[model samples]
Target chain A: MTTQPHEHIVKSYDEEQRRLVEEIVRMGQTAVAQLEAALDVVDRRDDSAARRIVANDDSIDAAERRISQDVMRLALRGPMARDLREILAGLRIPSDIERIGDYASNVAKRSIALNASPPMPHVAGLRALGLLAAGQVRQALRAYSEDDDELALRVRENDAQLDRQYTALFRELLTYMMEDPRSITPCTHLLFMAKNLERIGDHATNIAENVWFLLHGDRPLPPRDKRDDTSTAGPA
Target chain B: MTTQPHEHIVKSYDEEQRRLVEEIVRMGQTAVAQLEAALDVVDRRDDSAARRIVANDDSIDAAERRISQDVMRLALRGPMARDLREILAGLRIPSDIERIGDYASNVAKRSIALNASPPMPHVAGLRALGLLAAGQVRQALRAYSEDDDELALRVRENDAQLDRQYTALFRELLTYMMEDPRSITPCTHLLFMAKNLERIGDHATNIAENVWFLLHGDRPLPPRDKRDDTSTAGPA
Candidate 1:
């Protein structure tokens, strides 16, 4: 059977759309791996490995730029409303993933500074928080690729766990700093690292919301809990 | 002379583009004002005012959604490559501005926590950093509206100044915490606030780069220095 011109166009456009989504998912996986690698560096105090992860963030950034170019090219083809939403999601989800890469890089950078002092037990808490954040990002990416709004909502709901973990880490680090003046410098580094992990969770939530926007258009997302209360937190 | 239908369509498209730029500028101005107000509350130690600023962040978020909708509508109109670049900028610039608003709100939130302790001299340093960040955001927005690549580059260059200010503040707070353990809690809050302000500067830089991308599509930008060395920072 001979393929018609209109069929060819439709097939090519669908292929482009599939390619764009696949690229975004790959980029997101890179960011997740970067975060896990960073967490490992924190536990092992591997400054060189941390530096490598920091440099690797550029790949995710390059991915974002490429995805943007693809979206713009596809967009200029006069996409319909549904395709336009896909184009917008293509733009936004990568931006969020790029930021996740940055947060992961920041965590790795802080780990190098964290290595200056003796190891503290708080690194385990940070690891737990980082793992949770990575899971959120992974699930969000799955939701994006699968068009699973249910999974996106789950990712949003799960961010509260990451926030609570961060708050606990925040209070723990503060108490540790107060107990030993010498631990103040390293503990401060830990605090910023923890904040970065929490923000990674936020970025994951953003990606999930973008997935919802992709599927549901202008419908408002159900309000999720924001448990990151460290900004208002006081001494324990 | 009677205007043709095509000419009328061209004029309307031009108007839509102009309106998009103007809306983004206005939204950016709101974020800058929010940051300035957050800095004010930090200086005044006004928890109520801080809460107000936090609540006002919703306006910036709403503006972002509106701008995104406008961009999508324009993009689906089958714009040329140049106009498509503008549409992309419309998406990206507002996202950066929204993040700036979030950072500003975070500063305000932390100020409330900071109020639990005696006011320290570091608030002045924070205010200075915030003003610098706000100026960067304002300048980046102006660059976007005016199509001023030179001004965008200038804004990007000036972020180094913000970073140096942040690093100095980081050292000061760390030293203060090490000397007096009683100050650790408040100092930790100040450190995060400083980080938030520093991040606002980073977001401004992102906007500036987006302006550059809008003006010069696919052209590589010159490398700029990054002076935020706190990630590698140790005891001062």
Candidate 2:
């Protein structure tokens, strides 16, 4: 067999590395989709949607496995400095995405639990807060796939506001639980769902930070929001 | 210069690899210590321990930075097959440990919030659960440091038990919140603390799984437990 000059055979290393990045991007999209479905379940009490979200997590975990393999292969072949960080990015980004997927699944589980309870006050607030969280995840992934630090920084900045809103929502839910004990059960699931959303936002910020590190090398990241006393009511 | 028969006195890419592993092991110790301190804060409402845990997180971050650098340096220098996996382990394990540290800080923050509120019924349960979570982290790290698949498997298996205990604790807290609305506030804080502990357990399992992958090559990890329904009383 005569071997012709091959134009497509190149990029053995680059292709696998690219696949690792692409796989993570796909995983991020799936995670965002999962979050949307999970939030929808919360809003609609749709058991099927919850089931779908929980089932989708396996694919995200699978994507992480694929990325891990690609990273290992490329690492064994040895990478340049930049390639090394990219490989590290391959490792770091997926775990955050996977964890985000887990948070979405947790939200889905809460949704199933919420199915039995009648809707409580401030349930509407969750829908609004969820939009914010979902937006953060979307933007964070965009920054990751496109390597846009501006969008990543925006994601990081919005997380503080997200945390503040979460604190506000937690306070209001507590008030509802205090006012109507009947609200306690649904409200309890809602609070955990809200906390899960806030955590999803944190994971999004974490992805943003990873993107920053991937692009910027060893530069120090800005401090994430530390203000926890945002509730108007003093702790009692 | 006292030059011996050595070809060159330089990092043969192996020493740095070992240091990378060593650095992660040291970071693991610090993270477990932080968890211990954070749990102490929750148990005794020790303000100083809480502050110490919060402050200690920066060092863990620093530890992660060092590991990241080591990983990058080794990858750039190029590594053998085994060394490459070890380097990849350096990249993955530190992120999980760092997140555990962050969870510990969250527990510490909740501890401070609970400082003002009177102690609720399940506070002791948190201490017990914290021990379990802390022990898991320690054992997972031990598996990581020693490359012990059996111990890592044990860590993974025990996470289900941890989740079940968490479910039981959540039901009890919900009952307390329903019975006395005053327990609502402190119970709310306790619930978040408990959630943080559950998450820490999840991360420990993650580390154990990473250790498994690092030692045993690519393989399918079993499905983690998905049970969420454990509350005795139905919602609302």
Candidate 3:
């Protein structure tokens, strides 16, 4: 029952891969929590708390740096084709997560300025969008940890819904700005905040796509619908 | 004297690496060109040309995919520590370039909507910000191709100037919107376009940092200033 040296190497490599997945999952969760916390500060108009969330983004950035070092170390072990895919995903996914953290931090930062103005009803819409984006990110992280292509595909399919929500809110904000001249400054802040949430959804979708690549290699992903039409939107 | 087989493999590997750098440089140039074209359409208010620029973004995306495949292939060749850095840069720099293309497309898309409105003087300001961003991106690409860390640092340091320009334009747009409520819709579009240009500047800094990583391994980058203050800006 003695283990060969090759078997020992394989086991150690397996453990390293598992550690990489675990670290990414933790990093993803940190980003998700940051997003939720940012939404909370927006709801309560808690400027100090929002600033804290902005400061907290550095931890997610540090996590990315550490994971990158780990990926580089693992990559130098001369992995095979499949492990090479893992290495690529290892690099790609963390960068996406770091961006998610940034968007969340941006949301918090905007919430601080948003508090300076009188409260608007659009904050509720932004919170809902932020929650949907957080949920998608959570699902994508799970898919990556469990290696679930089905869940990854689900996350990818769900981005269009987020996009649609974003577009609806975008039109609503524009209408609001048009009606009330006094609301222009605050409404502009809400608009940027909502856009940040939409971008968070896009980043979640990016993580999901990386998960698919990790599982399926070079197989093409089916074309999915993109419903984020705000760029072409105008004042109606 | 006859060359050894080992030397032949080394020569071919060097050639492959050179090809990778060339492809990335070309891809980066495509993105820069897209940014400039998007600005042109903004200046001329040409909806058809803007749409064409939007369509051309697909090419930059395809370039990124091709570069990623090449990086994976190089990674599989079991490169040494230095080459591993190259492979990592090969993956990262193009993803940034691809995003630059996307932001350029967004600018073009927004320009279509903007064309429907009366032209304003702010397009000139956006053009200025975009050209600065494009210049930074061009320098970053050159730094990558030449492996010049000093030039990369210069690109990194120059982002604060871009940010200041963006914030100034942001405040100006906000002031314009407040003064003439009739201008809010078009001004809003300009705001987003300016934000896209600002994000382009940030991506250029990312590329410059990646170049630094490629050259210096794990050494920490010197802290740089960030001047994008629009998130906290208020209407004056």
Q: Name the top DockQ candidate.
A: 1
- Residue A140 error for model 1, in Å? 0.9
Candidate 2 lDDT, tens digit per residue, B1-236? Answer: 77743434235565666777788888988888888888877778787778778888989988887788777666665635655566667777898888889888878877877888776658789888888999999999889878899999999999888888888788788888888887788888777788888888888998998888888777767776653454223522
Q: Against the hidden reference, what TM-scores do the models get?
A: 0.97, 0.89, 0.96
Tell me the spans in candidate 3 whose CA falls farther than 4 Å from its real position: A1-3, B1-3
What lDDT does model 1 reach?
0.90
Model 3: pairs clashing at backbone N, Cα or C within 3 Å: none
When summed lDDT is taken over every stretch of 10 residues in candidate 2 chain A, the lowest stretch is A227-236
RMSD of 3: 1.8
Could you tell me how far off, in angstroms, the CA of residue A138 lies in candidate 3 after the best superposition?
Answer: 0.5
Candidate closest to the true structure, highest TM-score: 1
Query: Which runs in model 2 stand beyond 4 Å of their true positions?
Result: A1-19, A221-224, A227-236, B1-14, B82-84, B221-224, B227-236
- Worst window of 10 by summed lDDT in candidate 3 chain B: B75-84
How many collisions per candidate? 0, 0, 0
lDDT of 3 by residue, A40-91 (tens): 9999999999989999999999898789777877777744666777888898
